[model samples]
Target: MRATLDFLLNEWLDVAALTRRPRFADHSSETFASVLDMSERLAATEFAPLNRLVDTQEPHFDGERVNLPRETHEALAKYAESGMLAATQDEDMGGMQLPFVVEMAASAFFYKASIGISSYAVLTTANANLLMVHGTERQKQVFAAPQLSGRWFGTMCLSEPQAGSSLSDIATRAVPDGGGFEDDALGPRYRLSGNKMWISGGDHEITENIVHLVLAKIPGPDGKLVPGTRGISLFIVPKMRVDAEGALTGERNDVTLAGLNHKLGNRGTTNCLLNFGEHGGAIGYRVGAPGEGLRCMFHMMNEARIRIGLGATALGMAGYEASVEYANTRSQGRRVGTSGKDAGAPPIAIVGHADVRRMLLAQKAYGEGALALALYSARLVDEQHTGDSAAAKDAERLLELLTPIAKSWPSEWCLEANSLAIQVHGGYGYTRDFAVEQHWRDNRLNMIHEGTHGVQALDLLGRKVPMEGGAALRLLLARIEDTVEKACTQEALREPATRLAAAVARLEQATQACAACSPPEAALSNAVPYLQGFGHVVLAWLWLDIAVRLDGRTDALARGKQFAMRYFFAHELPKVDAWFSVVASNDPTCLQVSADCF
Candidate 1:
């Protein structure tokens, strides 16, 4: 249940060299542990109890308004009052200046408790972060302040009715306002007219204001629509207009709720179709330069990607917990090879069976592995921000390369772990009687949340893999090799070391094949397989790294780590073989299939 001890203390402390930095002079491991303790306590008390309630009683939307449970507002207020909303920001910005890794670790507790309710906080933090990075000084004071204090919520409006993932096809338009009405601090205002669909946390009464980070294109000098994302620009369109002092001017922006999008899971969070500038035009403040909305929004998109993975991991963790508790307490059939006497004997806990243990072990490998990857990615963010120039550059490149995997891998596989969690509970798991069912439903959205698996695969194989002439890929391999080398030194890890080394070799070959294959169409046909195989190799490396860390220990935790490594090596690692083969061969079967064949 507490893999954080091994990952945060043992893995990150050494890898990030936290103690050596003056920026962290006032902080220590104990400080970070206290955060975890507080988060665990708050999650157990506030969020965990409401997980099922929110799932069943979901937010209700009438034609005029959306209403959420009182408990949702209370829990979120407590979270904001706890100062976690600004945990990773600058002190001047009302943050504690904590390391990103610690912030992420603390967040996992709440995510595991209830992702549906946690959605509000996630969007607020990401919104504030984007504003800090790209917003003007006055923008932060006006928009980011209320969000950081949890008085206001935020949503990134990118997808439209017709443009699902294709930003280039977006039809939303923002025109410079020629009217005299304006604020002095929030910068130049524009009239934004568009409809944004699939906007989570888009419409809510829980906060005083909702900051909508809109993506719309500004027409060219010729007054014609720009063809693609190149014309897109980012805008800050609030539900209510605010003055320079961050007070509502009693005037509502033209942003209105078109309708609610009922979903299969995460029902506690309101997803809405937002109509911007319907009356005339919603007054919007530009966040960055024109034609840079996609580039600017990537700040939030990348953060959301990693957060999606962590949320998926947390859902898997929650499912695993429910399943394990059931397995330990529920009496089932006796051992398989029992006699007539044993047939009449008392049944044992289901966890005593081999198959159930396998299921639990698989969950452990995936859930914990995902946590490690998410935290590692968080550490990379910290490094990119504070490390020396060279280290920051390296971290930047590696972060880019790993971001797609960090987002997609857990989303795909951890959701699989949720399925196995259901399997561990058998028929009970399939029904609403068990929490695993909700967890499964909730986690399914993650694979399609930040980006679909297909989208991530294209990003990974088509873009990230070939960036900087493969320097980041080489760095990733070197890091894995370092782990493999250390693993080879121990007698217990030698076998895994060799096995993982072979996997790395195969992955290298697959990468080469991806780069060398001719024709963009042929080369990218099997990008999904490439992504899966690459993800497995990365997880294998992390598992081996954890195993090597436990080389001399003989405690139960060490044994668990060793067993998980064994399970990963024996069960999960080989999955890359078939996937890698498809990628290496540039298999065209799926691509070549005709629509009529179906």
Candidate 2:
């Protein structure tokens, strides 16, 4: 882990140092700080020490039940009991009402310790968020309250065997029972039947009850699949029914834990195949209006996407830290200039090697840049909810534009950092004796989590960039330009700022070229290039921002910040030119291919 700390020290720590700036002074106060400190301590002491044990042990499930590691359960209990579970929730719901920014920072500690274990907390938090937004009074009283109190856990069930990204293809159905729907004396309920696949924390023995927020189609009178997402409805389906006193009843609900998925990583969290209403109809309470389930679920999906990005960033940091430490201490052959014919020279640290330094620097650039991006997006979430109306609207638009990049870019680049981690350790990195290999394996999963790179690229170029008359993209560009302009006045930052400005101009031109295409599909075909181009511009701008902030600091600690800024500009910033060229290129080669060319 020394390598990981080195990467953080060389890259991410600069950003943390810059947080002392007045612009970032809005972070939470006493109560929030206390909660964050407690969370950090628990993550380091309770969660991190068990990461290797949990990963090797893995979660197990019988046909009827699921069992997690004892350490996993203990860590989860500590996490929930400490009020970290309610960090971002509203005060009315027995929460601390902390901002998303604080929650995100707190999450970094958990994720850095063990992403697989941290996921249980993240999923529950997201579930509570969705419930707070859409759940009815009684539903909130029954589900959200207990979850907030750590009495129950939550999971979101969306994917199915046949339906992956295309929700319209889902076969799950909720048919109306007696009198247009079973009019529950407490509230409206439905008979739900569906098989949900790839559900994290689907069935866990740690909590008394598991609440699943499922997406199922409810037929209408005219009923031709309710015409896409409009037909889908959100349902709160519990593992077991609870009595008036909130105690579990005798038998389980129709929901059954069909099987546990043996995944490549994140083994600590049980990913299960669940069958709702397999024996009998599973009783479910509607979260919101019928046909609005997809909208409601998006609330959770968006939050999860950000969390996935942060997790990916944290994993990359861990890998980089581990690799850097190995490079610094591990001794290898003599330097290139030394003569070794007869005289024996002492072995030098691997970190002194040029190629090793290059890999370490690359890891530092990607990991730190990704962390900054994720945190910035999280701060935007806080602004959207708590700021003034106009500020909130701006924050929302910027967030929509940034979310795909935040989710996809880190997953792509940080995984690269993990690969470099393995390379740094040579043969040792490939072995289980060191954690770097595990970090690589774990980081690999994020590339497909939430959404793939292709999916996010398509979303970026095909939808989000064009939404609301391109207002979001325009706002983002303006913000980047503003940062560039501010950096231009700083002598140390002017050159890099100008370079970033040029990249921004190229991106703008590419956006216009794509917009002007006769058929939009022509433009959409280059979405990947566009995404890559946009990400480069964003990272360069962030690096320039860091450089400008560091320029004003004169403290000894700031020397590291100065070195990182110089290294980023000298080595990393030049790649923006190549990315811009690719973005601006009009290669019709892909579109020109015939159907049977092969």
Candidate 3:
């Protein structure tokens, strides 16, 4: 099923041809294509073969002992050996130093092969990035180096039983141990005591050591939990202590894997309940300044959010591909005109039916657009970090503004694509004999992983869009305008470009209307709607970009591109106008209702 879809999308879309473009002229696209090629090959040959085995034989813990599937371990080893583990690391650290765009492209393959295993690698990369950004020289040498080398694994411990999204509610504490600190030491180590929940890859036999970046509150000079996020500090707590010689000969830290969580999907990775300071106290060293835990964690969180979106997009792509293949091969009934004339003849493939084609096309439109959106956001991240000052600032602003949309929109919409995939498979999709059901289950988790859609919507409409005088939003609009102007020169893309321009204008007006509302809550009340509206506009712009690139071409692949772009503009872009109407009206029906009305 996947093979047929891959041939159609990868071949017909000319994704490989796009990769072969000149490196100097389109370095970002070239590098991204290379990474995609590597990942796709690895996923097809290595990870895909073990996905079902790992899923069936999930990691298990026997209170004091934990064991992972042999295939899972071997796959991790293969990934590390293949240099995938270091794709985003620095060249000096034995990494490819690929841009974020390339990393995202690489990640899509893993996501399609096995989301659970990909999550482990994603978390490890994000955790290493945090250490590289904030860790002291000694800390980076001891921890970050090993992690990037895949010698050690990493996890972020932020959630506790008492606290989920609200960090102020966190009860974990880090107390000063009063140990004498050497001049060359990183910091005076502290005693960590608390429990963390929903810690992915928290306990596994995949690596020798696990580095946990925990968020804990330390007593301030004034003492009372220190008010808010300022009281929280980030700590580097390892599973085992290491000596000055970099030997693991010291005592094991008092951290314990309390239990394993039973989840609906993503079972290949261990989601653990971790207890720190069980026996005495788990020794931890501070990563950054005191009262800066949330800030450091946000760095990891932001990156994870974007990666999560990418993962979701990939799953959607796989699901859509599966459905398209199934539709092309599975015979059910004849076409409407031939139903009576060919009653005794063999049924036609489901793809011949109008309704089935609708479903497949919808999936294509949603999933493909989502991939472009995520990749574009990743490219922006690369530009933000590696580009010159002016470009960097612009990329940073645009990324900040689009982060919520990238994370939330795909999380919600792509799950819908997965659902459509299941419907396309009929009874087979419901059984374990087919992988579509698993795709549905796996994709469902993404909607809640980084942040729920509601939470992201609040962050986008309430904070990101309007904060700092909406500079980010304004910058994003200017870039879309620039794209529109460039697209205008291409004769074939003029109409779609004009439609996209109108959508952008509508989005801007809605933004201004919401920004001008009397109370902030009024603006936030329709945030979800606003996000939907803005997402459509962004996707329209992406389609126009693709159309403009394919303009003046006569090849088969170019025609396919033209078809997809025109289909998107004709069928999907109009939805933005409907959303625009809702947002522009600033309806209060939803907000006016009382909680008890239900």
Candidate 4:
């Protein structure tokens, strides 16, 4: 794992060059390695030991507070002590000011060890990062500071009981306090009343307080709510009320954890269905201007999406490691070759079998490929923040185009990797006897995390593909072509390069076909298929690029990359055609399906 990450960071992406940039000038490759080492040791010592403990004894509500094991709190306290909760922030804020790319690589260790326990810190960091970008100085001091220091945790309340992902229909209402309280110290104080469901890390006992970034609609003068997303606004509704000095007032906010959700996995974090203003309207301080809630919330949502991708990639790597460990040590079969096996010969390790290797190769293709894409996305983030004007503009465009792909590809394909890991373990994988079953169960939430699979599909095809007159799509394809052009120079890589180029051309044709359809919905009706095809093509391009970098390498790691690249092109890349064929043809079978047929 270290070798692979080193190759990706230094060789392929050239992350070391980032140190020359002013923000990271205080750092070096050695510092990045130290961070990675710390993360690995911490995860191994603290988080991994508690993976099963948290799963078996999931958090329970004793009606007074959510009950969690003492070990969970201690483990998180160690995490907070590491100063990693805000690794990418400024030095004045007690952060290392490391590149986001390096920060993400270090974070993968935690997710790999135990995603369930790691989720608490993940959501809190994402929430605090959002506030840093959009919150007022006072708001930042009162709310975001404690979170960054790990003294407080945060949660984002977007989905409600009646409206799931459809934020436009959210009915949460925030009314102004008419008793001379509009000019309250934190911000404009309002009374928020609504029920927020599926709130992860919503309520927990490990921290001094929880900051709820709630979305609610402020009533107009006519006492009627606005009709759509434009009317929504963001608010900082803390669980415990605070004074102007950021001191706890010892008064509980009107927020209630009505019930706890029993999920299949990721059971370590407390998922709550919270009722705001059950007794009276919960006091909320507006974050940004009214009617700008959706826009502001999406900032956090996009960051969360990529983080979700990282979690998926980590979980996939965990499963791969487990299955590979098992296969190399468990002798159950003989090597299958051109000739038959001898009856008197002893059985070899299962790793010698052709089918087991096939499964492992597929897992490698999906898991490592997902990791590459994730790190690439993180690098783009550094580019956007640190690069010069034109470079930053191009990076932003590419980042926008790849966000949904980054989120959805790993979420879908890596879950498949976890499944194949189970298959490699055979029956033992099915039972709780092995951790792969738990890995599969935990990964199941990713597809539905920030958004469902279909939601990401719609975002990819309906919005991202055509946004800014398709400039972002063209930029991404041009980069892929650059990789293709380089690979065509080598005899060994030429075949896969040509294959990837053909896939890119097919995607272009599909995009044109969808754009030419009479009604936009006709093109988007097959959005999921389009998303699948698009993601595969992207992965193919990444693999070919990695192969281009490895043309002269003869080591085992290089050999593994060669095999996985070949396997993906042979077994996985061809499926891109089937996914794109529907889009290119503008197949209306799905759109034309009658409800009566169901």
Candidate 5:
């Protein structure tokens, strides 16, 4: 897998070219290699050994402090000591400032080893990143710095019990804490009273304190809360009171953990139901201008969505690797083409079976393709931040268009890969003896985490596809066409190239049809199907692109990539026809159905 990551980063992506850019001028291949080596070594030694432990021994409330296994603490300590927490931040902020793509590649190892433990760092980094972008200087120094250093952890408190994913329906309230609270150095201060649900890493003794970025609404002139997301605001609420220097004041904030959620997987990370201002209003400092909460919080949410996809990808990779190893060793019955009653013949490994190979190839196609997609998006982040002005703007639009796919596609398909891994394992996959079932369970949360499948689908078809007169989709199509043209010239990849080009043209037509339906809402009702088709088409393009790069090569990795790419183009790409048909016709079968018929 490290070799696979290297192939995608160096040979295919030409990440070395990034060194020529001024922001990455100080780095070279060696620096990136060293960072990846350290991450892999740490993950293999510290995190992998504890994955099952953390899953079996989940966090528990002991009536005083939440209790996690001692090994969990040690693993995190080793992680923080590795300095990966600040790998992508600035030197002045105590960061190494590695290229964002390299950082993402480095994280793949840790995520595969243990995503439950790795989640804390994901939220902490995203939190610090948002504050750096939108917080005042003092606020960054106070709240964001420690989290970056891993001295503290962070969580985004967006969903309330009643509101779930609807920010407009959130009932959390924040009131102005008069008496010069607005003049406080942290920012405009407020008294917040609300309950936030599904707050991952919301409470833990691993860090000295927890920083909760809460979204709440303030009362208007009529003393009534505003009715929509426009009235929402973001606040920094710490578990304990901290002074100007980020030191505890020996006094606690009003924030309290109501309970811990028992989850289906990734139980090592604490998911909390938190009651803010249980006794009175919790003291909070605003992050930006009033009523700009979601606008500001998108900084964290979008990044989280991408990372969540990576997490799901890594889990699928782990399962794929496990199943491959199992198939190579586990002796099974003779092949279907061979004699059915060869009593003297020796049983062959499952890998020798055709159906088993098909399953393994499917896993590789989905899992590795997803890895490529996530890394491609990561490079876009680097391009957005460090490329020339025109390139940066293009990168921005590409990233915006790809974010939902990056989030939802892997979350859905990778879970299918996990399921295939389980099937390859037979009955053992259903039991706790093997990790494939656990991998499926952990990856299952990703489709719903950060955002649900339907949420991302609507966002993709409704907003990202048609944005700016469809400039983003057009830009993406141009890139795909460039790849197709090049791949068509390669003898080994011509069919894949031709198939991918046709798929892209169909996708374009479907996008237009969906956008032009008689009633716009009816088309959007079929958004999830649109998402499935669009995702498969995107993967087809990526696979063909990679195969074109490796067409003439005969090495094991190259052959593997070629085979997987061919498998996807043959077995997976055709399904998009059905999905796109639903989108192109703006099918109202589901939308027009009567609810009572159920």
Candidate 6:
């Protein structure tokens, strides 16, 4: 992992130069190295040891209180003490002020160790970030500060019982308090009355308070609910109200934990049904202008999407590591060509088999390539914020285009890697004794949450690809071509360079073909295939990028990277041809099928 991280930071991204910048002056390679070390050690010892324990002993709501394992609380406290919760915040805000890239790298360790426990921090960081950007000064001072300090946790309460992912249909009402409420550090308050569903980290006793960023609609002049997302607004409704000076008041908000959601995986994280105002109403304070909830929530959503990708990548890496260890030590059948009559023949390690190597290589390609993409996206976020005006603008555009892929590609592909890890373990992998089974189970949820595969495909094809006259897509294509051109200059990378170039060309052609389709719906019918093909080509480009840098490496790790690069170009990139063909054909089979056909 250090090798992978160092290659990204020192060789590819030049973290030293990034640190020397005025904003990151306090950071250095040595310091970031120490951060990574601490993260990995804490993950292995403190978080990872409790992963299975928490999984088996899921959180329970005893009607009045939600009970979690003591280990879960201890793990969170350790994470809070690490100073990483505020790693990327401004120094003046009681943070270490580390770069976003380094912070994400550290986060991956915890995700790999235990996603359920780490989710509290993820939600808190994203919540704090959102508030810092849009919350009022008083709101930031009262809510965001404690979240960064890990004194409180946060949740994005959007989906409701009747309306899932359809914010327009949300029936939650935030009626402005007409002097019945007293104002504190947070601004004017309201009475929020509605139920929120599937809220992760929604209610827990691990922290002093649970900050619920609830989405609700205020009544119009006629006292009727405003329709659609345009009328929706964000509110800061905590489990318990706090005074202006960050001290908790004895007053408990009307927010109630209705029940706990029993999930297929990630059971360690409590997903809950929260009633915002079962009583008169939950005292809520507006974050931004009324009816601007969706726009504000997108900030947190986008960050969570990228974090989901990193989480999936980490889980995939964990499975890959476990399986590789098993392969290296587990002896299996003899070489294929060896005779059965040769009693002297010895069993070979699973890694010695060609097919097993293929599986390992595939895992390596997906896990590491996805990691690189996530980190690259984080770096883009940095550039968007801190780079010069033009660079920042370009980075913003490119990031918008890549965000869907960053979220979906890893969720789709790394889960495949986990399956391959299970395959490498054969029968043993499916059993509880092996960790790969749980890894697969844990990763399965990522594909569905945040957004489904179909949703992301539509976002990538129907929206991002066509947005702004395709400027973002064109810039990305140009960048890929530049990488292709660089790879062609090297003798060792010429073949892969050619292969990747061809695949990218197919992707480009397919994209244009779909874009040019007369009716948009017809083109969108093939979105899933288009996204798959595009992701493969993107991974191909990334492989070539790594291959070009690996020109003079003689070490085994470097050689492994070279092998995975070659494997992807040869074995994986070609699959894009068929996928792109499906996209280019504009097949309407799925769209044309009748509902009765099922």
Please report, in order, the local distance difference test score of every candidate based on alpha carbons. Answer: 0.88, 0.80, 0.79, 0.92, 0.91, 0.89
The candidate 6 region of ten consecutive residues with least summed lDDT is 335-344
Worst 10 residues of 5 by lDDT: 335-344
Tell me which residue pairs clash in candidate 6: none
Q: Write the per-residue lDDT of candidate 2 for residues 1-598, one digit (tens) a residue.
A: 2232333333443334323434344333444456566777888998889889878999886655677778888888888888878876766777766667767877888998998899988889899889988987777788888888788999999999888877888878886656855456424677788899999999888888888999999877775457577789988888888764456786688888788899888888889888988866887878888888889998999899999988999999889888878999999966776553223868889998888988887888888778878878887887787667998999999999999999988888898999999999999889998988888787888878677787888999888999999999889889888888889898877887877887788888888888887577777777887888788778777767766656667865455445655666677666666755555565576677898996
Tell me the lDDT of model 5 at 154: 91
Q: Report clash pairs, candidate 5.
A: none
TM-score of each: 0.97, 0.91, 0.91, 0.99, 0.99, 0.97
| Backbone clash numbers for all candidates listed | 1, 5, 0, 0, 0, 0
lDDT by residue (tens digit), candidate 6, 186-291? 7768999999999999988999898899899999999999787889999999999877676889889999888999987888999999987887999898988888
Model 3: CA > 4 A from native: 1-35, 179-184, 338-341, 490-492
Ranking by lDDT: 4, 5, 6, 1, 2, 3
lDDT measured at residue 326 in model 4 versus the true structure, 0 to 100: 93
Candidate 5 deviant stretches above 4 angstroms: 338-341
Cand. 5 TM to true fold? 0.99
Model 3 / residue 219 / CA error / Å: 1.5
Q: Give the range where candidate 4 is weakest over 10 consecutive residues by summed lDDT.
A: 334-343
TM-score attained by model 2: 0.91
- Pick by lDDT: which candidate is best? 4
Candidate 5 structure quality by residue, lDDT tens digits, 268-377: 79999999987879999998999999999999998898899899999999999999999999998976654464666789899998899999999999999999999999
lDDT of 3 by residue, 1-598 (tens): 2332343334333333433333223444455456667778888887888777777888888766678888887888878877777776777877776656666767778888888787888898899899889988788878788888888899999988877777788878888877464233745588899999889999987888888999999987675567677789999889888765446765778899988988888888899999999877887888888888999998999899988887887788888888988898899987666345467778999999888877777777777778877877877777777667998898888888889888887887788888889899998889888787887787787878667777788888888888789889888778788879988898776788888888888888888888778776777788888888888888887767766665577876556556666777888789888877777778777888999999
lDDT of 1 by residue, 328-411 (tens): 999998877644337777899999899999999999899888888898899899899889999999999999999999999999
Model 4: per-residue Cα lDDT over 457-576, one tens digit each: 999988998999999999999999999999999999889988998999899999999999978899999999999999999999999999999989999999998899999999999998
Cα deviation of 571, candidate 6, in Å: 1.7
Stretches of candidate 4 exceeding 4 Å from the true structure: 179-182, 337-339
| Model 6, CA-based lDDT | 0.89
Candidate 6's C-alpha runs over 4 A off are 179-185, 338-343
